[model samples]
Target: MSNAAVLWRRVVAEAVGTGLLVTVVVGSGIAASSLSPGDVGLQLLENSFATALGLGVLILMLGPVSGAHFNPVVSAVDWWLGRRTGAGLTSRELTAYVPAQIVGAIAGAVLANLMYAKAAVSWSTTDRSTGHLWLGEIVATAGLIVLIFALGWSGRAAVAPAAVGAYIGAAYWFTSSTSFANPAVSIGRAFSDTFAGIAPGSLVGFVVAQLFGAVVGVGLLAILYPDAGRAADEIVTPHTDTTTTGATT
Candidate 1:
């Protein structure tokens, strides 16, 4: 097959993987909320487990195809860091991946809403626009990016499914905003007003904070493992993990 065809396959993988991931996240949150009414803690626990397990499974299933980024930030960062290494997405590939992931995320939220018999396209009114919330997002996203890239550098790519999932699950309780680490996820979650949604008004802050976190995460990777990142040059840089999803969201 041609190179374009290969990239297209990866693009499709990203779209499908991100879509299902969002669906799992939103759907689980809805189910958890419904089942554990008036019990916020229990609902969160339920959401976190389902999200963590589903994310891990999706990564394991689709990592070989698209590196399982599913997040625009992940895809963009991968392209930037791995460009010189030749083990990353091409500019063309990067362009394709981000939009596909975003579209998939939106679709996933809509699907979840439809499944639960809610308005399929209404904006979320969860209003998470606090400064501290943005700070939490930055912290969560930075930690995620740092973990994923560091693992790739250390040649422990196989641990991603478990480690990434665990970090998100843990970050949920620790972070005030429940760690909406993925931009695509933030966008998707904005569409739902249920237990897992974020207000559209807060999208900018969240996304900007995430991007800032990505920068910090990548910088830390460069400083801490100056030589380790070189190892990712030869193999596909598998910096894996995401901020959005029921588990982390």
Candidate 2:
């Protein structure tokens, strides 16, 4: 296969993987709200559990194709960390991956809404614009970046699916923002007015905080693992180049 074909396949994998992830998140949130009624705790439990499981499965399924980077921040961090070493996504790959992830996320939210008999594009009214929530986003995103890179540096990329899923599940409970660490996920959630939604007005702050957190995470990685960039190709999981014979870890 040609390099362009490989890139195209990877882009499609990222989009489809991200779309399914959002579907799991939004769909489960809708289901939880309906099943639990006024009990917010139970609703959250259901939502978090389903999201964790679905995310892990998606990563395991698509990591080999696109590194399963359903989050733009993740993609950006990968590029930044590996720019000098040429170990992570190229500039072109980053450009393609980010847009695909965002578009897929929006489509997933719309699909979730239609599945539950809601309007396809109802803007979320759930306002999450508090200082503490912004802090929560920063902390959540930073931790996620750290965890992903740590795994790669430690040669434990094989366990990323479960570890990443578990971290997000725990962050959902610990963070005030329910851990919308992914910019794509944040944007996608704004399209729904369901239990998992975030208001459109809150998007700017959340995304900004997430980007800042990525920077912080990278700084921390430099301190903890000076050679973390060497493992960039294995982030999220080991990515196999279709034109080549083996994984690029």
Q: What does the lDDT read for residue 72 in candidate 1?
A: 82
lDDT of 1 at 146: 77
**lDDT of prediction 2:** 0.93
Residues 1-249 of candidate 2: C-alpha lDDT, one tens digit per residue: 778889999999999999999999999999999999999999999999999999999999999888998999999999999988989999999999999999999999999999999999999999998899999999999999999999999999999999999999999999999999999999999999999999999999999999998998999999998899988899889989766788352
Tell me, by lDDT, which candidate is best: 2
lDDT of 1 by residue, 148-203 (tens): 77778878878888888898888888998899899999999998888999999999
Q: Report clash pairs, candidate 2.
A: none
Q: State the displacement of the C-alpha of residue 6, model 1, in Å, after optimal TM-score superposition.
A: 0.9
Model 1 — which ten-residue stretch has the worst lDDT? 240-249
Worst 10 residues of 2 by lDDT: 240-249
RMSD of 2: 1.1
